[model samples]
Target chain A: MAMKERLTKADEAKPWYGELPVESLYTAGIAGEKFFRSIQEKGVFLGSKCHKCNMVYVPPKIYCEQDFEKLEDYVEVADCGSLESFTCVHIGLDGKRLLEPMIVGLINLDGASTSIVHMLGETTVEELCMGMRVCAVFKPKNKREGAITDILYFKPTKQ
Target chain B: MGNRVAIVGAGMTKFVRRAQETGKELCYEAAKMALDSCDMNLDQIDAVALGTAPDTFDGVHMKGEYLSDGAGAFGKPYMRSYVGGGTGVFSVAQGWYHIASGLMDTCLVICEEKMSSYRPHPQGAFLTIFDHTTERPLKPNLLWIFALEMNRYMSTYGLRKEDIALVAVKNKNNALDHPCAQIAKAVTVKDILNSEVLAWPVQRLDVSPVSDGAVALILTNETIARRVTNKPVWIEGVGWSLETSYWTNRDLCYPRYVEEAARMAYKMAGVTCPRQQIHVAEPYDPFDYKELHHMEGLMLCGKGEAPQMTVDGITQRDGELPVCPSGGLLGVGNPIAAAGLMKVAELFWQLRGEAGKRQIARKPKRGVAQAWGDLMQVGTVVVVGI
Candidate 1:
């Protein structure tokens, strides 16, 4: 007689558990909303320049982190900056694809002391470097909205 | 402080890959055990602090609310605090504040995680830890970050992979004596080297396995502690600090946040030199290299000196400073939140001379448990002394 085989509960149960509700419209604070709007208008992405330390924050905030004091509005920043760090992702949550084999880089926006996280497009993994200059590519003017996706990605520019 | 706070009771469920009970049920089990150990009931707890890491694990938002009743927080002052893997010790630190501040005489602290609920792979939830715009686009696995840190540590210190593999071997060997250990095995550096590689340098054995479990502690002021138990482990100091979220911009070779937090904790505990003052330590070890990383951060040893101590057996169970005598996250299991609290529980047991076979050879007067979490930059430290 053939030996009997037993199945574990997990083997018998449903493979997938539950799904998280996905939403497109991510709500940001007033300061964050304005930062996104500035990018959509082709104006330099500006942040509050700390008068105390002369530090420039790319995403303008209500208060300075270092001094915990209210920040003053500053001028627009240049589009070009150098890449600080990057990684190439192959897998995603829920076995879904945001973009296959996408390369993401942390680009230090010009005129800002700190770097802003953004996608790196139209660049090969081998071409990426720590201090490579790149410029933000904005969406079409008609399709522009107050969102981070307004600036599609950063691409290497010939300086 | 009006009255000193001490952990009067501690309890935990059996750590496992998957549990038949739900997350709430696991919490209730641990809470019931803690209350039972103290000969007290839910009504005696003045406030409840629940700690769990990442809502992605349980597939529920505001997990504290879902677990409130089971954690004995119904109609009571309740707050949920989280700092990634450091959440468990952070929960205990919050509980200490309630008693020390004279706001509450007794507090029930619960730490639970149900990672098994995430089907197929718990690694799925880790994808969200990256920067949504840039890093997330790369689809990097959580192991990649640890691999990067391990590589940096190795290159800076000129350490070999075998030296780090010994940590996994020792920790797993120690877990054999723990009743709640999830993956306790007696293996060697060869076994670790032979294990499948997840990312470069980080093998399957080098990383902690995902687990589901719960741990709870009942803390009370000195007055209530005397009434509850003859032996109570006093919480001498608590400190926590967070570095910038810009982890990529900072040096990954060492954890400065942990060192800063440890300094604050040791100062309050009146510890002049941690090497001589601390008898045992439970540094967070979600990854094998993390144990060495935190050892330096906690000042148990100077920077770039921990690997030497491990190689010299100075960190062994019988050595000068027995680190992770509870088998740590490496051997025990990595349930994130519960893992940190489990370290505190180990100290409670060790200081009281109740660790059974896993007890250190030397008598312990003071023990420290530290945890690191959140984008490789937050450190939470707790000092408990007899």
Candidate 2:
């Protein structure tokens, strides 16, 4: 194999800098469209049930991953559920320190087989406890759109 | 040396400019169709082999894992293999080994690509494929390399652009008969010469469009294949080769790697006379000139002679040696790996006389499918027969 000549001086080697220079719009997929749209329009939670597999998925999908069965049956699940886990985040996506620590928790919605991660609100770490019930807090009707952020956060439910 | 492998089922989605389905969903549609085509359930499939374009195109990390369940590899021996464009054909070879080694009686092979996910344009992802220090400094895209290669091929044989335009004209016209074709139209050589020039010597009509689609096939050993379907297409031979990344050093006129890959597959299948023995061919045609270039490399025709054959109508559906009866990447679409496997699927459909309107006039017994990709480097070849 023949190798190209190496640069002998820094001045001789002028490097070029570039970025991807492209933006993208990804679809939420067959399951995600139904999942997000329902939240955006009605503030209701939807789950897909597979009759053959006897399983239900929160953030409902088009098919059952384990059984490979088509899942088109959508059922409404209560917005309130139990907290499975929690974490405190101190940094932002851009690698900067956040002004306030935010609580993120994984909550298992009632009547769903899986859990969804979301922001925890209206409570401090000192008051938060595992297995405690939490209810979803949706954004105002006018500000609502088809996205995960439509559900502002889950707060400790008055039990 | 090992148990023979045969393809029992095949399916594909329509190639399109954009698809609302995610990559995983694309895999599911194809996989489901393949299983249904052979009257078999997913439970009977023992293992899975998958191939697709690199993760860069979709901007998704660990894409193989994300698509695992979609390809029906859940709780099964699943493996992902990709050689850029060669990925589609190579996945079949991977599935063949699973059954041939007796490790599994049946294997499902899938190939998919969704270039539309790359946004603004899929070509942006190609910028990173270049050597960051060397080629990237020049800001060279895929078209730059292909344009350079096309010029070399044309000059080497004293061929004219009008001569190469016949391939585009023929393939697009043939694709009018294809069910899954994205943009199949009838155009004259004059139309090709008059199209907008993206790069010199490489016009808009001279290239295949960006597309999103997927294909899947079920491969089983001879014994199981006989039970699945009576018309099983055997995987006679499989071969792949990759050249150096430094495209500057290599001769641009001919694809040496493609020749080597074709020779390996031909030798394995005992094909001493490729031109005479191979009944049909489906060589990669991302660019109009690539079909002719690969035909020469595959030894289907003499170097620089593919143009004359095209002029003579020998590559048409009713001609003596029909090429790209499924419309190929040029006429149908180029979804990277999916397009490559699409050729293999075409061979299977043609061999079984199941290609509906796209069926060839002659009774072809054997066929070859080839794909080239990755920085003008790798070549993958597969030979299938009835």
> In terms of TM-score, which candidate is strongest?
2
- For model 1, the superposed segments whose C-alpha errors exceed 4 Å read A1-159
Which digits, one per residue and each the tens of the lDDT, describe model 1 over residues B1-386?
34699999999998998865567667777887888889987768899999999887887689989777667787789999999988988898899999999999999999999887775577777777787667765668788989999999999999899999988888988898999999978889999999998897999999988998999999999988999999999999888999989878878999999998898889888888999999999999998899999999999999999989999998889988999988999999989999999999999999999999999979898999999998888999999999
Q: Report how closely model 2 matches the true complex, as a DockQ value.
A: 0.53
Quality of candidate 2's docking, in CAPRI categories? medium
Deviation from native of the Cα of residue A61 in model 2, angstroms: 1.8
lDDT of 2 by residue, B76-191 (tens): 99988988888888888889889889999999999988888886788887888888877787868878989999999999999999999999998999899998999978889999
- Per-model chain B TM-scores are 0.99, 0.99
CAPRI-style quality class for the chain A–B interface of candidate 1: incorrect
The alpha-carbon lDDT assigned to residue B212 of candidate 2 equals 88
Clashes of each: 2, 0
Model 2 steric clash pairs? none
Interface RMSD of each: 16.7, 2.0
> Per-residue CA lDDT of candidate 2, range A1-159, in tens?
767787789888676656776666677888888888899888899999999987889988777878778888999998999999999999999999999999999999999899999999999988889999999999997898888999999999878
lDDT of 1 by residue, A1-159 (tens): 775865668668444333333222223434566677777776468777878778888877544444333455765788889999998877786677667688889998888988989999998899888898999888887798878888899999877
